[model samples]
Target: MADGCRRRIVLPREPHAELAAVPLVDLLGERLGFSRDTLAEIKLALVEACLNALEYGQGEVEVEVVAHADAPARLEITVTDHGAGFDVSIVPQPDLTAKLHASRKRGWGIELMRHLMDEVEVHSTPGLTRVRLVRKRKEA
Candidate 1:
């Protein structure tokens, strides 16, 4: 791994594909000097993104990582799936009060990612969905 490197991984639709994504994050995190807390957050967000891609997406899932050579070293990760997409705008806002009393308790992936990463962008169309997450290492 070099400075300002790019890594891409394509995973099949399997039960443990999400787990497979961990090493990529760990490698980049260690090489890029990500703090323990930041590395944990990135790993969590990546796993959630993979799970969403697997559950709602179709076929295979593709993940791309780019390490930026900047003051803080920005890391951008994109997860893409080939499933039929939906309107990201229509996703309901998560409400703790509502969720606590609801019969079914799920649908927190996007929100969790947003909270964990510095930036989270989701692009979707009729045939594809992509979740992009960006994080910057806090300078020590």
Candidate 2:
């Protein structure tokens, strides 16, 4: 690959689900030069993404991380699953300013991923679901 900062990892769908997502955050955070706190946030974002994949998707999960080798490094992480597709637009946006909040044990992943990353994209077609997350490298 010309843009040499790309890595792809395929994780088997297993009982210990966090196994798949943890290493990804470690690798991504390392590659992006993230600090401890920032790395934790990235891990949380991956957790959200992975949980959704494990819960709804079947079979192995695919994760991709793309970054730059040059100045002002930036990275994009994509997690994909072969599962039932859902409409991303249908997910309600959480209002942080509101006093009352909707509290349910479901549908928080998308929102969390969106809040943590600079950009979040969801794509689904029949049997595949892909979430693309972009994060910028902070100046050292």
Q: Largest lDDT belongs to which candidate?
A: 1
Model 2 Cα shift for residue 30 (angstroms) = 2.1
lDDT of 1: 0.86
lDDT of 2 by residue, 1-140 (tens): 35446777786656766556566566656766877777777778877877787777877788777766455666677888988878888877766645155455455678888888878888987789998887776786
Give the 10-residue window scoring lowest on summed lDDT in candidate 1: 1-10
Model 1 residue 3 CA deviation (Å) reads: 8.9
- How much lDDT does each candidate structure score? 0.86, 0.74
**How many clashes does each candidate structure show, in the order listed?**
0, 0
Pick by TM-score: which candidate is best?
1
Cα shift from native, residue 54, model 2 (Å):
1.6
- C-alpha displacement of 36 in model 2, angstroms? 1.9
Q: Kindly provide the TM-score of model 2 when superposed on the true structure, using C-alpha atoms.
A: 0.79
